[model samples]
Target chain A: MKRRLFICSFAMATQLFFAATLVLQPARAGSEDAKSSPTEVRVDNFTFSPETLTVPVNNAVTWVNKDDVPHVIASNDGLFKSKALDTDDKYSYTFTKAGSYSYYCSVHPKMVGKIVVQ
Target chain B: MAKNDRFDPSLSGFIEHDHNNDGIDRRGFLKCMAWAGTGALCVIEGGILKSYALGSQKGSAIRSHKTASFSFVQISDSHMGFNKPANPDVIATLKAAVDKINALPDQPDFILHTGDVSHLSKPSEFENVDQILKATNKEIFFVPGEHDVLNDDGAMFRERYGKNSKGQGWYSLDKNGVHFIGLVNVMNLKAGGLGTLGQEQLAWLEDDVRHLTSSTPIVVFAHIPLWTVYPQWGWGTDDSTQALSYLKRFGSVTVLNGHIHQSMQKVEGNITFHTAFSTAFPQPTPGAPEGPGPMKAPAEQLRSVLGITHVNYVQGRHALAVVDSSLV
Candidate 1:
């Protein structure tokens, strides 16, 4: 009887340890997402959230559109341009060299954003 | 003034931009009144100008009047392949527009597709618009709306619709003594800018009209509003004032534009600026409290702009591939 009770407790402890790891896995991945990609800009209501962002060198930035209307993310100096992003569509660009890059919506030029890589 | 008697100068500044106090509210009211005055047919007889309200009085005057030479129908913003709650089937509405154009007692000489001919600049979208418009059997003239120049920057648009057009799809046609200039203002837009006619296009426009006699009635068509309607909404063109200066010598000038999705009109001196309704959906009129935010359509025939949005995770995706020449 004593042996059986001990075995049951040990099994429950292992199961709890594994379950805790399963729950923590996504949170860990999310933090890593924050660390690696480091930046996210949202296009909403005809404006870019964080209209300006600052990040370290070699970091990637992703612009996700939150508007139903299509928007194109284009750099001012003609360095980079993205395809027309539909609702929930995203375009990612990495900054290997530090610089101040200005961008705007090619479709609606009134919408503008900037990124400063230091 | 009554719809039938629109020529009376008492019409107020309906064709001009609304003042700050009356901007959206009054124009919002006209959206309803437009049902009564869908198209304004005008004729210059002897020395005076006469206007006809198409929907209200079926213009027996135009038929009986011997001076009326030619007429063309304008349909703007087909937005083909747009399947949204606002308008699930844009094809049907375009067909209805064509039907109305054909049903006119005097068959129009041609059709003017003022832009937004496609939803995403997809080949299929352009192809679909082409196949559907064949029912009209009229020579269709086109200008590239911002929507039409997506993807490859209007290369597809120029290839399909701009055969005889020069540089950026601008061209002039002389139809029944009316000099029609289709300008391309939806190109190479700078950050925080309105629609632009580049320096090259401006020079071209200057020379295009230099030789025409002042008596020749001029019709200017473009994708964006040449006159300032709402700068905050990007409803106006940036270099249009310069473009208009070239036309000042002319006695009669008509500017037809499409982009706002709802129709509005203004007459600044002899230049009549008019915007046409979109065939796919209706956007909320500008100057609303919430601002004209990202086509939040609703109101007019189709209330609500028909879209929702959320962020997407790129998941370690690489930077996108881009080309130098796009969005002309």
Candidate 2:
């Protein structure tokens, strides 16, 4: 009778352990994704801070203008265009497919930045 | 003419013209005006500039001046999208300019906006300027300012205004016996560099003007000053010398510009270089303590410093008579 009780308790504990693992796995994976995606570039002093950025597919990248004057981020291939971003203005675009994108400021053409998506 | 010169100083001003073949006579008049005052109207006749200040002894002498063949208004640096404290309401100021143009005693044949029609190259901003300018009932010509070409290499601006223009939006039009060349120099800027007319545009310009007679009056308008107005602020054009070389043969070459946001005039040989005031905001003088940007002054005085230019092309004048007036 005691042996039967021990077996039954062990089975219940095993099932509970499996249930816990099943619930925790996706949460762990989701946090990892949130950590991996880097999605921002800063504009200040007439330049993009991370002139080159890398991101995952379907991730969005935001460009925030911190300069006193105005700026614009335009893709070379006519993919994306931002309006004149005055101070504190922000522009964002999502990378749906994996590719490389190059852009420059329309005001200051010398100011350029690149993005690579994997 | 000699008998009348002894009694009237204003008549003596005309005597100076007889000696203008030497080019020293105009310089002497400029020196006299500098010592007298800056508020004076100067008329160029047969290559001589005669000054007549308002209420001066010679002011009425200019009233009998011959009628102009045609006249046009020059509005620059409207900067419609700018919402900063320096000039929060650019649209209002631009409207005032249009009102000023509409109220002119003689309606202009057309209007030439030197550049900077928008502050941020926003499509909405362009549309706003178009809407306001439409109220003037005058045809408008546009060249891209650096600000106008900020997005997609000015793809939006070119689409709207440069549809009939060549690459980078440089084109020429012949109107009423006058040849007007609109140039693009604000594109492809270097680091804090001066404006440039690339080799492509320069070649095109040479070919464009090749067939025209030297007697044809050429009006070249661009965003930045073709001359080195103030290189320290990147206010000059790099390849303008080459562009001006193509125009040297012309009897009257008027190069009008508008980046400085203030009125400044210079005459070199047959070329008359004039920079107009902005309709948006005034920038600091080139050598002021602060570098170039929107400058803040007394709020009420802003409009008094920002305005448009009126140019009259008299039939026999050496060049256009440029008059700059503040909105106030």
Candidate 3:
């Protein structure tokens, strides 16, 4: 009886360990996905060609200012600020939240662009 | 020759035939002949000869010599470089407007161009506008519209027109007992929103109007509507109240703006706000689903829809009449 009880306890412990591992697998995969997923944006000619962008939550988005003029990648919602990126400069931000983000060039207010994290 | 004769063809024809007649020298006879020929040609051009002659006269018929009465014309949204379907050649339309102003019986004291002188703020675009406006006899005043500040930092506009302007091209001038103020709100536009007059400019504006008496006639010109014309497309100014509050004490305040490419007027107590139609193209009205572009109408209706404004300020009376007339 003692041996049987001990075996039962061991079996329960193994099952609990497996359950915990299963629950933690997705969390680990989420971090790995964030590290691997990189969404790129190109800014050119006083406008962001794809002015409206969409990306998966936890993905990193990069803005490359390919134009001669300087631009600011700033979110109105205060999510990020790429302080005055000059020509050929780049800025990246990891969007961990899911929502629509509207941004504009602080220097040139007429220059506006948006991003959607889902 | 019969004296006091209504039709003495024989006498006149003889005078025409003879190189010298009635002691009028050969050169005098030739001059009279040229004048008579031109008059006859003008008469033949239209049935209403008097009206035609008066129509050829330049400027507004509202005389400026009447002591205590002065007038100026307002033309907005010329959009000179725009070659879209809304207007094939805005320069030609602007020329037509200039001709209209020139044909007025009394020339305006000066002309005010509210904004959007160029479609893209391109150097070539501004240069073209400069050449065309130079033909006009009246002095021109300008303020920057959102479109004109699109590509550059308003360098092209500042270089060309804003010689004596201050603080993002806002300035004030006094003419004919009235004060004129030009404001710059199109520089720093907001997102899915209205234009903005920054804090510094607002402070300056407050101080500028503080000294003026409540009865002073104030003419305020800007690109965006000081009152909310439409908020969805960013047609209104964000801090217009802060600007308007300064002018509220003035008895006669005229607010002029352009951007939506349509004519609209509103009167609030002592203030009268007016928007002039574009000389280029017509945009969709407020809340139209067309997404802020030149709305092409039926070919027959295009000219009637596209129009310009004529502002006449009667001195001492505080009466300003703004008439909108179409190119067609």
Candidate 4:
């Protein structure tokens, strides 16, 4: 009986060890995603909310149009460009390098925004 | 100023027809609007606004080309740096328009470039337009298009050409007993919506025309159509009705616009709305294809589709003879 009890405890210990390993593996990935998850820039009221955003290099930034009109996103340095984004439309671009990128709505020139990837 | 005497078809009989006929869907109405590309010339006669196609000869009762007191040329949507399949050589076309204006039988007193002076809003693009338009040598007045205000909120445009403008590049001037109002409506465009004049600009416009005599002839020019042309493509203005309310008391009012890349005209009460063709490229007629954008016709037909407008205002008669001739 004692031998059987010892075997059961050993099995339990192995199972717990494997479960802990499985949990830790995803935990690391989850933290990485938290860093790289796309940051959002809302286009509303003819202005970009949080006109300036900072993200890690290679992170993705998504611009979602919340206004009723259409807007196009084009970077000043000609790094990224988007089609006419109508209401609720979204455009995302991932920065491969770190630098300051200025963008404006091609439809509404005065509506400008900036993004810093570091 | 009674509604019954108003010249707007919508206020007269068209609105009634629109409601009574269930078969005329929105698409059908848009199909009618497509013919607006033919160009509508709004003429004020006997204190009533009337619009007819520029080439139509049916209006013999009101036809009077006897004399024109003064004339001006309107060139719009030059899009200087635009290089696309639709129009690869925007500069050539703009130069052609300038040549046409220069060769007019009578040199236009001045030139009114409605908007879209540049495509990418680059300094070099504006410079290209400046060099080309210098050939005309006529006093030029400009209002900002959405494209012109792109990078610096029109600070560069204001610095370069809009020095005399009021807030956001809107202003008024008097020329030969006529009041010309240059309005900026493309500043804060609504999403998937038409242009907005904003409350501030509207208030200023109200005050600007408040003290003017009812007999004063008014000419209001902007980038977008003051009337609702096509809401689906943001072709019209949002608060234009309010802005226009101030001018209804005037005996003659002519509103000129550009941005649809095609010509269209409408007459409502004392207001005569006329849109001009772009010097860069032609856009699809409203509801012609899927939507409004750069439309490439046969390469040979490009010049025929693009053109400039010559407007002649008679002093006492209040008759405006608008001639739209192609660059070809």
Candidate 5:
């Protein structure tokens, strides 16, 4: 009986150690992926240039306004409004929820662009 | 005043001299005389004469009369703070527009500003436009161009201009026998550089025109082109097809817009889409280049290129003649 109890305890310890390792591995991998991912978006004349973009959830996206005129990084559902970004100005928003988000420049209605967060 | 009008007292001397100088190689002299005659004529009309000599050609002067017929003046893309080569003083050009409207022999019932009253959506810019427009004696209606709503959640534009407006300042009014619908498409733009009317506004527009008869003259105004002008430059609206779908039933539809800062017109069925020129500057023609920005011209030729659009709506006819006249 004593031998059996010792073995059972050892097995349980090993199982918990492996479970902890499994959980920690994803966290490390996420950090690594973020380091490799592109986080900056360029807002140029009348376009987001890259019409569709994919980024990990919880990762931040920074939009840099490269046009001479002003632009707003606003979500379709009123999720965000970056106000007016002048030339070379920047606005950053993090995606906490995983979903496709669309946005546009409220000033120039025709100037529309979107982003997808996964 | 009647004799001065017909005789053109300023040209009386030149006409008399050219008639008598027949012995001086009349044909060659006529060419030189014509050149000299144009210069002398400028002093009579105004010191600032456009060299294009468009004014020299005698066209029937526009006859203005105050009748019950509905008329409205359209002013778009004022760009008040713009100080670029396309136009140096946008404010001055706008002032000239106001003057031109006031000087019209028959004053319009109202003035409609399609959008882009300010260059950067700044409060000061709005303030400047307000002060200048106040000089006019007619009522002014406005819609936002993307530039005017760039900052402050469009608070500055709404607070100043949206007092009686509905749903982000989008509303419709009945003037004479026409229905005027002002729409907002710049609220939420989409990727691929397309203008959006959003779901809410689209529903409202559908319902707004539901009760009206198909024979009613409908005039829809917005900042972005309702039809595709140049998608590459972000000049076209994404859901414009949805908007135009509703108006397909109308007998006479006119869509007036301003954003591209150039003049272009298209006629589809009963709908006529016209884009106005910017009081600020001119952009490159579609596909002229890979990008869109203020296009500079020779310094002396700038004003002649950047002009205003004049529209005449004749009663008892569906024909609308639009003429774009430069400041020069």
Candidate 6:
């Protein structure tokens, strides 16, 4: 079991290393207005836009609530959770490890999303 | 709108939408009301269902007053502090609800706020609701909606609402020979989005009703609908079946819930599940194109879509008669 876990981490580490190079690059001029990275998720109309997101290890991602109702983001595992994000409120999390993550709005579980930390 | 369309809130003067109790029977009456868009007061006298539309009743549920031994109002999803296009001034609408409750023939024994007393779980939100609900001058009981427990895992909600309750605020009360069990199912929600009444609460539920006789009438109030209204929308509870199994021996079980933000009713054998409307806003029906959220009803019809439920318990009756009254 330990060996298998190690093998999985090694694979993820390689993917994370490659992923880092993609996001670690500096943004071209005027590119800030048009995000070059998938670092933000918007909660609107009881849904997470870009239902799936991928980022490199240690990359920070933020979720902003644009809807009038409040929403809570909670990871499937006992990992990260957010306080209720009311309209125009935001919560951010930085992934430090490489793996697949699943989350949903605790207030409305039907609104689900995923984050792939490579 | 069609002339006879039942949803017209403009209708006036005590209209009994369906008075042919002889043909419909209780089962058929429920089947019809389950699809009814307007509010109704259904009185079960001697196992027959007699219903009156609230659009004309003004608030009194007058027909059932004679047979009802006691009545309590159920209001859900007040969503205090909700300032969306749906219903900009939730306070005004909630005050309207208080007015409707106060207008009833005999003041309901108490009020059951099924859940969502606050929109954002903020202290101020709860306080605003407290101030508005105080006008009824009736004691209010609560179960927290998922929205209520969002911040601090419901620390603020339990502190303000369920001080003497147990385990994330689940408790049971006995009043006038009727048993009321308040359950909490919004804490520690599981992934894939479904309501959960964890093992601990289920165990407590089993032990809670152990002593009641089979003749007892049980009313279960919670934030989420226990029956599977639409699992795709996370409208149902994961472990509610087990919690309900504990109450199977009882003659009648009525489950009142909120969070769907629309009125819906379902009957399954001995159990009847009814969901109340939000005093603040309406929501889409199950399986709508956009998904469920604070639905924006046209301003004029907003009050008609939002409503409260009145449940009357007649001594020795097979079931409690439920009356849903709109804020208008």
Task: Estimate, for each residue in B99-184, the C-alpha lDDT of model 1 and write its tens digit.
Answer: 66666555667877889898888889889889988998989899999889987778889999998899989999997677899999
TM-score of each: 0.75, 0.71, 0.65, 0.69, 0.68, 0.83
Question: Which lDDT tens digits does candidate 3 get at residues B73-185?
Answer: 77778776666555667788888777767875556788888898877567887888878877777799999986576646577788788989888899999997788999998
- What is the C-alpha lDDT profile of model 4 across A8-112, one tens digit per residue? 565455434433332211112112443556588888756788999997754557788765345678786655667556557677665645789888775755568
Candidate 5 chain B: minimum summed lDDT over ten consecutive residues — where? B41-50
Q: What lDDT tens digits, residue by residue, belong to model 6 across residues B169-201?
A: 999998888899999999888777588889888
The candidate scoring highest on TM-score is 6
Give the better candidate number (2 or 5) by DockQ.
5
Computed on alpha carbons, the lDDT of every model, listed in order, comes to 0.66, 0.72, 0.64, 0.72, 0.65, 0.76
Looking at model 3, residue B270 earns an lDDT score of 58
Evaluated at residue B36, the lDDT of candidate 3 is 16
Cα RMSDs, all models:
15.6, 13.9, 19.8, 14.1, 14.8, 6.9
Quality class of the docking in candidate 3, CAPRI style:
incorrect
The residue pairs found clashing in candidate 2 are: A106-B150
Candidate 3 runs further than 4 Å off: A1-52, A56-101, A104-113, A116-118, B1-68
Residue B232 displacement in candidate 3 (angstroms): 1.1
* Predicted chain A of candidate 2: TM-score: 0.68
Which pairs clash inside model 3?
Answer: B58-B102, B59-B104, B59-B106, B59-B107, B60-B106
lDDT of each residue in B1-328, candidate 4, tens digit only: 0011111122111110011222212223211121223334445554344455545573323334546778899999998877766778999999999999999875789999999998867899999999999999999999888878765778999999889888998999999888999999987664335788999999999999998999888999999888887776677888998999898788888888999887665555556678888899777666553345566655777776788988888888877766566777
Q: What is the alpha-carbon RMSD of candidate 6 to the true structure? A: 6.9
Docking class of 5: acceptable
Clashing residue pairs in candidate 4 (N, C-alpha, C atoms within 3 angstroms): A68-B191, A68-B192, A69-B190, A69-B191, A69-B192, A70-B192, A109-B150
What are the candidates' individual DockQ scores? 0.42, 0.14, 0.08, 0.06, 0.25, 0.57
lDDT (tens digit, per residue) of candidate 5 on B88-184: 6888888877877777555677888889999888889989999998998778889998888775546778889877777787889988778899998
Q: How many angstroms is residue B230 displaced in model 1 relative to the true structure, after the best TM-score fit?
A: 0.6
In Å, residue A20's CA in model 1 sits off its true spot by: 42
